[model samples]
Every structure is written in structure tokens, then in C-alpha cells.
Target: MAFEKGGENAYDVVIIGAGISGINFGYRLQERNPDLSYIILDGRHEMGGTWSLFQYPGIRSDSDLYTFGFPWRPWTEETSIAGGPLILNYLKESAQMYGIDKKILFHHQVNAANYSSEHKTWSFDVTANKTEKKTFRSKFVLLCTGYYDYHEPLKTVIPGIDDFKGKVIHPQFWPKDLDYANKNVVIVGSGATSVTVVPAMSRTASHVTMLQRSPSYILSTPSEDALERFIRRWFPVYYQHKLIRWKWIAVPFLLVTFCQYFPSLGKKMFRSATEPQLPPTVSYSPNFTPDYNPFEQRVCFCPDADFYRALRSGKASVETGVIEKVTADSVKLTSGKELHPDIIVTATGLKVRVGGGIDVSVDGKPYNVPEKYVWKGVMLQDLPNAAFVIGYVDASWTLGADATAQMICRMLNQMKKEGVDEIIPRLSDKEKNTMKDAPLLRLKSTYVKKGKDVLPKAADRGQWQARSYYWKDYLLAHYGDIKSSIEWNRS
Candidate 1:
């Protein structure tokens, strides 16, 4: 269906962000509800969201591309793990192929959204090109802005960092022209970004050190999938994609389930797998071993054991301790040890921001996002004609986003058929008071803990709970009660 440009100020749906979730939702919205007029609004000049923003060395997806790719479009690349450029190309291709790119309005940032109870419409205060002000109205709003703050990263106070004479960098905004060749580099943090940068920078730097306050669970996997290749060669082309995608999905799901259920055994399994990859000098306990169980925080995947190989090559090393202070040219550890480096890279983590930091109001009154609840992990409690997408932490993020798109599409269709103008996830004051609050993200990571108050409240059960499993969410989206806890109106 060709989308003719409708009115400049109004639409049936307004999808904020032209990133992975927005693109997926756009495709699903078109395929499922072609009659609805919608437009995608992105603050950035381009698509691909995180993939487009981060240009750090060795930037790649920790999850395999098979599951990370869209369900309608399969990832047929030889390597399961993909770099940033390749993934960006795939997203652009997918958007263009499905005509999603045409519906996107770049340089349009939504600063505030106000929902009217009488009209049952959302009026968005948008800034175009960071200057011109505009208003766009829509019956429904989809917040595909993702979970993190794009402009600012999580700030960690490194003692005496300001006094460091060497070049300091954050992985979030890597300088394009910065050179580290033949220079000693120290990466602060042991997250996915740090692990990726260590191996990637080690190839050019004279020496790369991974400085961490504590250890994290890191596992290695094959970059190329021989089994997937074998299946593709033998199976029919029609079933090949589904098989490969499910294979990737099920494997991770089972592994995470095992880890959650049997943490001790899971720890043992990870330790056994990692012990052989480590250099003889580096012990598994002090560097590779995490105090928490596997999957408690995300498990960093080192494709083809590139990280371990870098360590074995003597170009990269890990240091586990607290930083006492930072000198002009060296970092002092609390263990009374010091190391000199030419550069320091902060790979701490991201700061979580819900609804792309847009100020949301209802009927001219401010909406407290943190005080409200999330219904079915898609729509917010007491918010009419709106939904948001947040992906899975344990598995591929696309899976959860796709499920949310499907559910929202189904709800919109139902509302249309029933002649309802507005649909809100309603909960009584008593129920809200009695329900136990739960964290939306079930990770023990520092970023998740610090940004808890920014997100919406969640319950332990019922439609108010935050569901993570893709399969279960898919089932619920397709067949579960769409009217549960929902209030409908014809305004």
C-alpha cells in the first residue's frame, strides 16, 4: 500500500523514533491495519537508532543476528554475529524494502505529548530541525524511543579524572578522528562495550587494559554457525529461515532458564567453558568470575573467543580493583598498584530514559510516569490510546519489540471494529495500592538499578506485570484477553 502524505499536522498513529522498534512497528502497522494513517517521527537525521549512534571500535551485536533480525526478514549472513555497519545496512534495507522509510519524518523531535480525554486525541509539541516548533495530532501514540537517554550517558565519578592529562573518551560518542595506534589504552568497566573495545583496540594499541570494579560473566561463542549452514544446505528455503531463527532463540532461552533455575550449576558450566580460554597467568576467579550468577546481569558474548585471543596474544589484560585516584598519566588502584596509559575510555553503561524523555500530560495535567503502571508490558495504566515498546533483556531485543507491535496492532484493530475511539488500561485505586511493585527490568546491572525511578511501575502478576519471554508474550498477544483491565469509549 502506497502511503500518500496525509495532513502535515494529524495522523491516526504517531510512532516516535525511526529505530528498530519504530521500523518494525511501522511494517506491522501497515501489514495489519492498512487503513490507518501513521507517520514515524525521529529526532535524529538517520535511522538505525543505537547502531547509527555508536561508532566505537568493534561495535557489534552481543546477540546473534538470526534472532535479532526482523521476523518477516531473516538474517542470511554467514556470520551470526554482525558489526554495526552491517546491522545498520540491514535495518536501512528492511525499512526501504517495506516502504517504512518513506513514512518517516527525520529531524522531528517530540518534546511533549498531551492527551485530551474529551477528544481522545494526542497533541504532540514537536521541534523540527531543533528550531521550528510544530504540533501533530493523532488518535494513538507509539513510543518507540527505546529505553536509554541518547544525549547523556551514565556518569561514574572517577576520582581525579579531571586531572588526567591523557585523552579521555566515552564509548557512547567515540571520536571519528581519534587515533590510539601504538598507545596504551585503559577501558573503565567490564560490560559488553568494554569487552568489545578491548579486543578491537588491542590490535592497534601498544597495550590495552580492561579496568573493572568487579568481574562479570563472559562466555565465548562461534562467530559463524556451522549447524545453521548445514540446515540451510539441507532444508527447504521456506523453512530454513524459521528453523535458523528459532534455533538461535530457543538455545538462548533454554540457557537463560537453566541459569535462572540452577545458578550454581550454571556458574560451574560457565566457569568450565571459560577456564580453557583464559591465559595461564590470569585465573578464572579474580578476573573472569562474577560474584553474581549468570544472566543476573547480561552475559557478554565474545565471538570466536576474540577477547580471550587478545589476552593470549599479550596485547590485552584485565585489572580488577577500585580506583583510588587518577594521576596525570596513570590510574592508581586501591590495591596500591598504578598503570600508565595514553588514553582512558569510560565504558560504564547507559542512562535509562523512558518515553525518549518527552514530557507527557493528560488533559492538561502532568502524567507521572514512574507512579503509573505498565499494562501487558505494552500500554501504560490509565493512559488512553497509547503504547510503548521495551525489549527483552535475556534474549534478542527484536523479539519482544515484535511481540509488542503485534499486540498493539491487534488492539487497534479491535478498537476500530468495536467503534471505540479510546482504550485505556484502567486499574482501581485499591488494586494499585494493594499490588506489590516489581522492577520492569529484571537485571542486577548498575544502570538498571540506578534508572528504576524513571520507568513506570509494574506488578508481580496480572496484566500489570512485565513479561519478558517472547513465546509467552507472543501467545498472549495473539490470543489472550485484549479487554482485560481495559476501558473503552466512543468519544
Candidate 2:
């Protein structure tokens, strides 16, 4: 059903967020069951969740577009690492192409959702543009919130930060008119945002300094994939796209496997990729090389070696040290060095929120999200008629998302055949205990570490553990028995 303002609340399914995952879920679910009534809701003023929110300098996709793009929709963009504007356009085009644009409600934020055991429906209380609470009802709720807190980034308190005189900006809330031209800029944190901003800002700014407490493995990739370009030029559009997509998909699997089995080899290869890009005067040890093994934290990807090029051109530089204090004109380092800057950008990671930070209750009892175990990395244990669109840490986020969408579609279709009203993945007492003892996310990133307590933990057995490989996920999504793990109830 197309979404209308102040329309009826009832639906077969309600998908939250109009981001990459939500748009795909709406398209895939409808493709599976055309008669299924569904609506896409987003709190933003328009479509494109992450693509719309982040308007910082040089914001781009960390993963290549072929693997990141939906399987049904081939990404025809020439560049593998797309700029934010291009990515936003791709999302908007997908929405319009799949008829999902008509099914979306802007300025509608899901506040809370409650599951009724007797009625076998999900009742959602949402606030429109922070006012006018509305009620929506659906048999199933699909959370495509992307796991991050949109309201605020993961801002860590730094001593003497208040004393800094220059304009301090977080990439999440980048000011449009903030003049940085001819100004010295200092960016803190060594993640994706830091690497992206350093090169972009350095082009216009007088000087840019990337100050990091620790280094992360950063690799420079060509903006366009050579193989994808060749295929696009030689083969038919359909064949070219599919072949290139599978090739990009296999690249990540091999990289991750090599990193897991041979740590030294992975580290050497990663270092070698960046070493040639740096100037001879600059050393790779302290500021460029990370002490941890490859894949411990996410590998930061920069296109066309822009970050390295900026450093070589003497427009930007890197500093690895702890912050002692932030003076009015400079940031004092623990190593007794100070960096004078006119602008400071905080590239510190994101704050992940489970279930879009919406208060959820089942059977009138407040449900603790972190306490639950995930089944097939989609549905939470004992959460009837619900699934979260979470992605893989190892590969393109959409690969896992696509797999989960297919799995949900299969489950919903099977439930209809069996005349089941409520479906919940339940674990025994022993299984619950096992999950409680394990970590929710295995990543070593700062954002994951900070929000681990509030995320869903993966179980050790069955369809509970979060699988990273796409082929394994595809086989399970297409052929796995849903009834073996789920508890089905009839109306």
C-alpha cells in the first residue's frame, strides 16, 4: 500500500528507515508477495538515510559500488568508490524505480513498538516531526535503521576541548557555511571519516593535520575497478554487471580469509599498498602502520590515493600522539608537541542504537534488546513477527542485508501456507545462557566497543551465529528450514 499522510495504520508489514536496507526490503518483500500491504517510514525530511545525513567533505562509500549495490539493481556508475552525492542519487533512483518512493512517509519517526500476543500484530507509536503522535499497526515490523544513532555521533569527552577557540565540527553535523578555506584544519580520529576529510579539506585549506591516538590500516584503491570497466565495455550490460558483482564479492572473501589465516602476510600486503604512496621523509611505523593485526578494526579505504597524495604534496600531514590538552590556538600533545589550527573536525566513530532506539515491549513487558540472542542475524529471540536488517562487518554491508531480506521473505511465505499468525525464534535456557556469555559484535572498532552492551548477541549454534560469507548466507536463506528454530503460533 502506498503511504499517505494520516492514512490508516494497518498493514501486513511496516519497514522502518528509507536507507539502503529499507528500500531493498520494501522492493524484495513486495516482489515476493505482491498483495502484502507495507509502508516505508523515515524520520528525515526526505529519502536517503546515511547518504542524506552526512554532508561532510569527501564523504564516500568505503566499499565498492558493485558489491554494495542491490543484486536486483546493477550499479552502472563508473567509479567503484562513489561520492556521497552520487550514492544519494543511486538511492533516490532505486526508490523511484522500485515503486518504493510512493510507499514512503517522510518526517515520521517510530517512537515505540509493542507486540500483542492475543492480537498477533505490532502496534507502533510514532511522532511526526517531533510532534503529533500517531499509531500504526502491522503484522510484522522490519527494522532497517542501519544500527547507528542519527541524532548524535559517538562523541567522547576530551579534556580541555571547551577551551579550543576554533570551530569544532563533527562529520555528522557538518556546517554548510563554515569557512575552512585558507585555514589550518586539524581532524582527530583515524577511521574512515578522518581519512576522507584530510584529503578533501587539504585541497582548499592552508594546511590539514590528521591527529590520531592510534593508526588504522588504510588502503588506497582506484576510483574505478579495472575488471568492471573492461566487462562494461566488452560484454552486455546484464552479463557485465552480474559478473563484476560476483568478482567484487569474491575479492572480500579472499581478503578476509587471508587476513584470518596468515596475519603477517596480510599485514605486509596492506602496508605495501600505502608505503609507495608516502614520501621518503615520512616514516610508516608510528603514524601509518597499526600495531594490531589486519581486519582487527575496519580497513579504511581512500580513493585514488587522495590522502597519500595530499601528504606528498605537502598540503596535509599526520600526527600520532595522545592529546594532553586543547588550548585556544593549538592542541597540546602528550609528546610535548602542539598543533595550531583554525578548525578542528572530530572524526570519532558513530553511536549504534539497536531497533532504532525505539522502546519495544512484548506482552506488556519492556524488552531488553541486548539481552536477546539473534537468530540468523535477522530476528531477535522471542520477538514475534520482527527482524532487523543488520549487515556483515567483513564484506559489503548490502550482501548480508540482501541475504536477510530473502530469508524474511521465505519465512513470511511459509507462515502464510501454514496459517501461522505469530512466529518467534525462541532459545532454551541453556542457549540463552550461552549467548549471555558471548559478545554481541566481534569487531574491535571503537564504535562497536562503545555500543556492544546494547546490541544483540550472536549464539554459537544453529542459525544464531552471524555468518559473514554471502554464499553460505545465500544457501541458508534459500533452503534453510525456518520452523526448526522458530515457534509458530496460530490465531
Candidate 3:
């Protein structure tokens, strides 16, 4: 069945967010169930999601493009690490090439979604362009909203930040007219954003100082993959792409595995790789060393060692200390060291907002996500015909998203075969009481810890367990018993 246009606001499937996850799911739907009518609704004016939203200097993918890019549409670029504009273009091109672009409705924000048990359908309250209200209906709803809050970043209260005379900027809302040419800049974080911004801003600014309370694991990787290039030269395009993508996926999986099991060895490996990249003046301890083990928090990656190069050139530097207060002209550290800057960039972390902050209810009763356990890391327990995509923390997000897309498609097909109107993951009261509670996200990062209350709950056993491995999840999605712990209904 083809989707009706004009006044029609109904679909067999409605996917919220035209981001990477939504686009991938749309393709899977077309491939797996061509007769199903579907549409992708995005709140933003553009379709690139994060790539389109973030306009910070030197914005780029921390993960390699080979794995980050869609599985069907391979990233053929020479460079594995890519800039924002390049990635945005790739997404747009892939969407257009696959006819996914035509299936999207931009500027349509889904505010609330309610499931009607009697009707076996979902009704969405939507706001168009921040004003016009509309309603849409679907048999199945997929939230591909990603994890973070788009409107607000994670709040960090810097002591007396109001006293700072210089311009304070957050990377999320970078201004186009803001100029920092030959100006002193201080970036207040040691994460990926800060690492990226320091190097890029150093090119034009008089000086850039990355101020961090503590250091994070930072590794430098080659911009281009020589092995991929060699494979491209010898193999057919199909095999070449497959080989390259698998290589990227397998290597990261192995690395994350090693880090998780042999944390000491992983720390050693990271320290060895990072120590050589630092300048003579900077010591490995305090400045480069992290208190936690590698992958405990995500390891920051610097392509072609751009960050190190900036530091070596004396254009940028790293400072490790606690902020005491901010004076009119400078930031006062507890150690008595003061930094005077014309611009302060708060490259702090992101705020997690699951389901895009959409109010979800079933039969007019509000559903609390954090209280509910996730079934198969895709669907929530007791939620009928609904799923949300939360990607892998250890590997590429697309890998997990693809796994989810395939799994959801399988469920939809099964429903058709069984002649069921609705499918829900359910647990008996005894089983729910006996199951142990676990966190949905495995990371111990500050943002993850802070946003624990906003995320879905998990259990330690069976289908209730949170996502751990891509291959394991992939196998489960394909061949695992879909009937396990699930209930089917006809309305």
C-alpha cells in the first residue's frame, strides 16, 4: 500500500525523526515489507539530525565513517574520519539515492503519542513549525529520536560564571556572527567536543586552552585507512565495501572486548599510544592520564593527531584544575592559576532526553519509561507495537540501529502471518518481582549516570537484558524466539 498524501495523516508505520536510525529503519521497511505504508516525520527543517544541527567548528564523527555510515550505502571516501559537512552530504545523498528523502515530512514535531488498546493504534499529537497543531495515526510507531535533548545541553554550574566579562558559548548553539580571530579562548571540558574545538579554533585564535577538571583517554588515529584502499584496488566494489566495513566493525568490537575484560592491559595500551603524542613540556600524568580505565568513559579520538599538532605548535594548551570562581576578566582555579580569555567555550556533555521528550501514554494512563524494562533492547515491556532505537555505546550506532530495524520488521511480518492486530512484550507479576534491575546503558560516564532516571530500565536475564554485543544482538534479532515473553492480541 502506498502512503496517501494531502489531508491523509495515517500510516501503517510512523517513524519519528529523519535521523540516521529513522532513515535506516525506513529502508528496512521497504526491503522487508514493501506493501506497508510509512512516513518519516522530523521536527527539524533539515534531515541530517546531529550532522545538520551542530554547527560548531571542527564538528566531526568521533567514530570512523565506514561503520558509522549505512550498511547498504558504504562510505567510499579515502578518509575514515570525516567532517560534519561531508557526513551531512553523505546522509542527504544516501536518502535521495534510496528514495527515503521523499518519504520525510520536515518541521513536524511529535509532542505526544498515545496507544489505544481497543483500536490497536497510536495517535500522535504533533506541532508543525512550533505553532500549527496536527494529529497523526499509525499502527506501529518507532522513536528514532536519538538519546540526547536537542533543545538543551547538559547543565554544569561553573562557579560565578556570571561574573565573567568575556563571551561564554556552548557548542550546541554556536553563533554564526561570533568572531574569535586572534582572541584568547578557553574550552571548559576534556571530551570529544572540546578536543575537536581546541584544534580548529587554534588555527585562527591567538591561543586556545582546554580547561578540564580531570583528563580523559585520548588516542590519535590515522585519517585514511591504507588497508581499505588496498582492498578497494583488488576486490569488486561489493566485496570491497563489505570487507572494509567488517574490518572496522570487528576491530572495534575486539578493542572494546579487550578493554572490558582486561582493563589494566587496555589502560596500558591507551597510555602507550597517547604518551608519544604529547609535547615535551606536557607530562603523561595529570595532563594526559585518566583516573578510570579506558572505555569506562568513551575514549576521545584525534584524526591525524590534529589536537597534538595544535598543542605542539604552541597555539593550544591543556589545563587540569578545579574552577574556584570566574572574575570579570579571568577564570580563577583552586590551584591559584588564572586564565584570561576573550571567549569561553563550554564543550560540556549533552543532556539525555529519551523518546525526544514525547509524553507517552497507554489507554489514557501515563507510562513511566524508567520504571519499565526494555525487551530485546528495542521494545519496552507492555508497550504494544512500539520501539525506540538506542544505539551501541561501544561500537557504531548504525550497527545496533540496523539490528533493531531488522528485528522490528521480523515482528511486523510475524504479526501479519499470525493475523494479530497488536503485539506486546509482557512479564508476569512473579517474574517482574523476581528479576533484578539493571541499567539500560552500560557506560559509567557522568552524563549516563546523571540521566539514569530518564532512561528505560533493564533486567539481567533473557530478552530483558540490555544490549551488550552487536554480533550477539544481531543473532538474537534474526533467529531468536520472538514469542518468548510476548503476548499477541486481536482488536
Instruction: Pick the TM-score winner.
Output: 1
Off by over 4 Å in 2: 1-7, 433-436
Question: What is the C-alpha RMSD, rounded to one decimal, of candidate 2?
Answer: 2.4
TM-score of 2: 0.96
- Candidate 1 wrong stretches, greater than 4 Å: 1-6
For each candidate, the alpha-carbon lDDT, in order, equals 0.92, 0.87, 0.90
Candidate whose lDDT is highest: 1
- Tell me the tens digit of each residue's lDDT in model 2 across 106-169: 9999998999888787899999888889999988999999989999889788779899888999
Better of 2 and 3 by TM-score: 3
lDDT of 2: 0.87
Q: Comparing 1 and 2 by lDDT, which wins?
A: 1
Model 1 quality (TM-score): 0.98
Give per-residue lDDT, candidate 2, residue 482.
76
lDDT sort, best first: 1, 3, 2
Clashing residue pairs in candidate 2, if any? none
Q: What order do candidates take by TM-score, descending?
A: 1, 3, 2
Error of 3 at 187 (Å): 0.6
Tens digit per residue, CA lDDT, model 3, 269-295: 988898888898777889988888888
What are the root-mean-square deviations of the candidates from the true structure over C-alphas? 2.0, 2.4, 1.8
